[model samples]
Each structure stands twice: as structure tokens, then as C-alpha cells.
Target: MNRSLSIIMPALNMEHLVGEAIATTTRALQRAGLSDYEIIVLVNTSRDGSHDRTDEVVLDLAKKDSHIRPIINHHFKPFGLTYWQGVDLAQKENVMFIPSDDETIEDSMVGIFKDIGQVDLVVPYTVNKKARSFKRRFVSRAFVILCNTLFGLRLRYYNGTCVVPTKLIRKVPMRSGSFAYMVQVLVLLIKSGARYVEVPMGIKPTSATASFKIKSVIEAIHALARLFWDIHIKGVRIKIPF
Candidate 1:
């Protein structure tokens, strides 16, 4: 049977929340009358033993429901690499990247799924910015502003969860191995003339225990510089049907 959508969930040490994330995603898909979808959980290496637990849980869920597919990466890689691996393995035309700990977007999943074929990409922006930390909120706003100014596109948000055509994604030359990869992919897609639609979605507050390091921000900045060079200076854009 052909699958309509493939949800790629990249998890590091999300043992406490991955189960609920999967449950919410699966339930939303099913509720939307979308039985032809697959949830691919790509578990990265973790020192907290969360990877092992995630494996167990995903295996059990996969046993009960064949739509749940889990891939365990033996070596630790950044979120972007894990996400790219899932994209390569996806069997659907439409692909979505959702974090393992995110649950606030469940209510909007059905509507997003319904809009799958209407556009080449579906970009969802968080409706609740107050849920984020001040630093996070500030950095996110600056990043989006910078991207829009540099790319000449007016996108409300660049880091939020988005759905894109698998073919378009596959054609783009993606190189970022950090968290900035999502932004890089979006920018490339837009430059490739992929039509997109933005929707408002709710976002949960950041977990108190989650790690938000300055090092990640530095890495994202570096990746953004490289992306700008490639897109603006080098004139890199994939040729895709709009």
C-alpha cells in the first residue's frame, strides 16, 4: 500500500516524552482519516540510556502497529543528519519533521495533513511565542528576520515544523549537520520556486530540563553563513516543478 505521509521524528534523549509524541501524532493522523501514513522515529546516540528505552518502546509500538518504524543510529550525529537519514528512508511523497518532545501541534496536525497536496510545502508558525524563553524568542525572531532580509522572502518563521514534498527535499543539496539544517532546507526550497502555505499552530513551553546551549547557537550561526554563501553568493538552487 502506498503511504500518503511520512513523519520523521528525530530524538536524542527524549525517553520521557517520545512515547507521548508518537501517540499524539499517530492519533492525529488516524483521526484525520489518514490510515496511509508512517511514523519514522530516528533515535540518535544518547548517554542517558534514553536511546535504549526508546528502542524498546518503538519496537513494542511497531509490533502493535506496523506504521511505526524506528531506526537506531549507532553513532551520535546532529539533529540534521538524523533528519536527513529519515528523509532518505521515507516511502511517502509528503514528509514532516516533528521533534520528539513536541505535543502542542497535535490539534493542527489533521488540518495540515489535509493540505498536503495543495502546495509544495506547508510551513507552520507557532501561535504562542510567550511559551518560549526570552532568549529563544529573541534569537528566533532575529534569525527569521535575517533569513527574510537575505533571501527576499517574507516568512513568519523558519524553524517551526514544516511539511514538504519528498521529491523537492531530495533534490536540494543539503549540507548542514546542525539544527540549522531545517532553515537551510526551507530556504533552498523557496529558491527552487516551491510554492508554500503557512498556517498558525500552537506551541508548548520549552521543557525546564531541556538543554539550550550557547554552543548550538554558534553552530547555527556558522551554518547560516555557509547557507547564505551557497544560496546568495554561489547561486545554488535546485530546479523543481513549482
Candidate 2:
């Protein structure tokens, strides 16, 4: 079968989450009635020996199902950003980005590929079923609000798994941005006038475990600065339906 969907996961020290992610994505795809999809596990080099574990998982899964491909995302200084590079490495017409740590969708959610229609991208909104702390919720909501109001691009969600077309994902090669690749992706798509649909995810884990540390703040600012420079300062305007 001419498989159209490609699942791209950029793993970084996700030993704990890798197994579940791979299992969930693959099983979900099969349950959705398309079992020929490819699952690419791109793990950045880490000291945690994730490389070995990844190899084992990918090889074993590949033996059972020929759709799983594993590769080490090697670099001297890891960018701490995989959402962009990971999908680009995929060899499929459609690319889905599911964070290794958070995000667990159902087989019905997997069917989004069939239901995607003419939309260029599909970004699912997360429902945090677990009662996370108040501080994390506040920050998450605040960030969404700031990005929407300040940028005028009301993207329903930002950080969870986002399924984008291969063409759109390829256009966004550079990982230089203020937040992570996703924020820049939002800005770029808004700049490119890409149409999108927001699917409400069933239950998402609170990545908002503790209060934001100083380091995380710095990374956020840097990611945002890069976006501003690329869009406004650099005079590259990618428009969206505000």
C-alpha cells in the first residue's frame, strides 16, 4: 500500500517515554486501519545511553513491522530542538510531530490523517485531564494568550504533537527561534497563510510539573527573539487568517 503518513519522533533522553510513544503511535496507526505507516524514531545523541535502547526498540519493532525506522540524531551540541529536524528526516508525504514525553492520543485521533481534508496542517489541542498545579496551568494559558494577542495568530495549541504536510515541514528547515521549533512553526505558518484545523486531544500530561526555572526562561526568550527577527526584522512575513 502507498502509505501516506509518517510518524516522526525526535527523542532526547526519553528512555522512559520512548517505549510507550512508539507502541502507542504504531498501535494507533494499525487500529486506525492503516498499518503501513512509517515510524521514525530520531534520537539526539545523549549521555543517558538512549542510543542503545533506541536501537533495540527500533530493530525489534522493525522485525515485527517493517514500518519502524530508527536513526541517531547526532550533533556536537544538541540544539535541544527536534520538532523541525526530526520531521524533515522523514520520507513520507505527511509528517506528524508527537513529543516523546507528553501526548497520548487514541486510535480515533490517528484517523485524523483520513479526516484532515484540504487543511495544510493539523494541530491538536491538548486536554490536561490530570489536575496539574495552578502555576503551570497559569503559565501555559498565559503563553497561549500572549502568542495569540501579541502575534494575532490564534493557534489553538502550541507544544503538543502537530501533524504537518511534508512540503510545509520542509519549508521550515531552520531551528533558530525564540521558544522551540513549534513556536517558530506557528509564526512561519501564519506567515505562509497555511490553513489548519485544531483537534481537541483527549487528555494531555502536564509538562507544567514545577515552576519555570531561570534556564527555561532564557530559552523561551531566545526562541521568541529568533522568530521576531525572522518575521519582522528580516522582513519575511508569513501570513495566516487572523
Candidate 3:
């Protein structure tokens, strides 16, 4: 059976929250009258016993619904690799990336399903900014400003969860191993003249441990520099057939 949407959830040390995240996402899809969908949980290597617990939970969920696929990666890879691997495994035409601890707002899910094939990309921005920490909020705002300035596109946010066409996303060559890969994907898509529709969504505050780290920040800066040089200096742009 062909599915309409595939949700790629990357998990690492989210034992306490992943179960609820999966359940809430499932419930949201059902409430939106969307049954033709699959949820792929990519469990990365975790030393905190989260891997075992997530394996158990996802197996139990999969028994109830065959659409839930849990993939365990013994060798830990970067977030981008895990996410794109799940995308490669997706059997649906439309793909969405949702972190294991964060679930998309029900209203936003419904809205995306309503406009599934109407747009090339459905970009969602956080509406409840006060719910996030000051540091997180500030970093997110700064990242958005930086991306817009560098890419010459006026976007409200660059790192939020979005619903994108699988084929179009696959067309964009991804080289970043860091979290900034999402930014690169969005920039390439925008540069390719991909049609976008923004939707307001609510995101829960990420935990400090799961949020930003010094290593990630440095990697992000490196990724941004590479993207700037390739796109602006070398005139590198993805050519989309759509």
C-alpha cells in the first residue's frame, strides 16, 4: 500500500519523551483523518539506556500498527545522515522531519495534509516564542536573520519542521553532517524557486542537553561558511525540474 506521508523521527536519549511523541503524532494524524502515513523512528546510538527502552517501545507500537518502523543504528552518525537515511527509507511522496522529543502541532499537521500536494514545501514557524528559553529563542532568531541575509531570501524561520516533497528534497545535494543541513536544504530549495507556504506551528521548548552545544555551534558556523561560498561565490544552485 502506498502512503501519502512519511515522518522521519530522529531519536537520541529521548527515552522519557519519545513514547509520548510517537503517540501524540499518531493521534494527530488520525484526528486529521490521515491514515495513509508511516512513522519511521531512527534510533541513534545512546549510552544512557535510551536505545533499549526506545527499541522496546517502538516494537510495541509497531505491533499495534505496521506503519511504525523502528531503525536502530549501532554506529552513531550525524543527525543529517540519520535523517536522510530515514528519508531514503520512506515509501511516501511527502516527507516530514520531526524530532523524537518534539511533536508537530495538531492544527499544523491538519493544515499540511490539506495542502499536501499544493505546494513544493510547507514551512512551519514557531508561534509561541515565549514558551522557548531566551537563549534558544535568541539563537533561533539570529539564525533566521543570518540565513535570510546570506541567502537573499526573506524567510521567517529556517530550522523549523517542514513538509517537503520527497523527490524535490532528494534533488538537493546535502553535504553537511551537522544540524545546519536543514538550512542548506532550505536554501537550495529556495534558490531553485521552490514554491513555499508558511504555516504557524507550536513547538515545545527543547531540553538543554538535547538543544544546542558548543560543538554543534561550531559545526553550524562551518556549514554556513561552506554554504555561503558555494552558493554566493561559486554560483552553485540546484536545478529543480518542477
* Model 1 residue pairs with clashes: none
- TM-score of each predicted structure versus truth: 0.91, 0.79, 0.90
Q: Which one wins by lDDT: 1 or 3?
A: 1
Query: Per-residue alpha-carbon lDDT of model 3 for 28-121, expressed as tens digits?
Result: 7887677888999988875443344766777677888888998888767789778789888988888988878855666666666666677788
Model 3 regions lying over 4 Å from their true place: 1-3, 47-52, 205-210
lDDT of 1 at 66: 85
Q: Model 1 — which ten-residue stretch has the worst lDDT? A: 46-55
Candidate 1 per-residue lDDT over residues 1-242, each given as its tens digit? 22389999987767778888888888788777788788999878764434557667666778888888989876777777788888899998888988788655778877777777888889998788888778778877887898888778899998777998888788878657777888888999888788889988787776654345788778888988888898989999888774
Candidate 3 lDDT trough over 10 residues, lowest sum = 46-55
Computed on alpha carbons, the lDDT of every model, listed in order, comes to 0.81, 0.65, 0.79
Following a full C-alpha superposition, what root-mean-square deviation does model 3 have from the true structure? 2.5
Better of 2 and 3 by TM-score: 3
Superposed Cα deviation of residue 63, candidate 2 (Å): 2.6
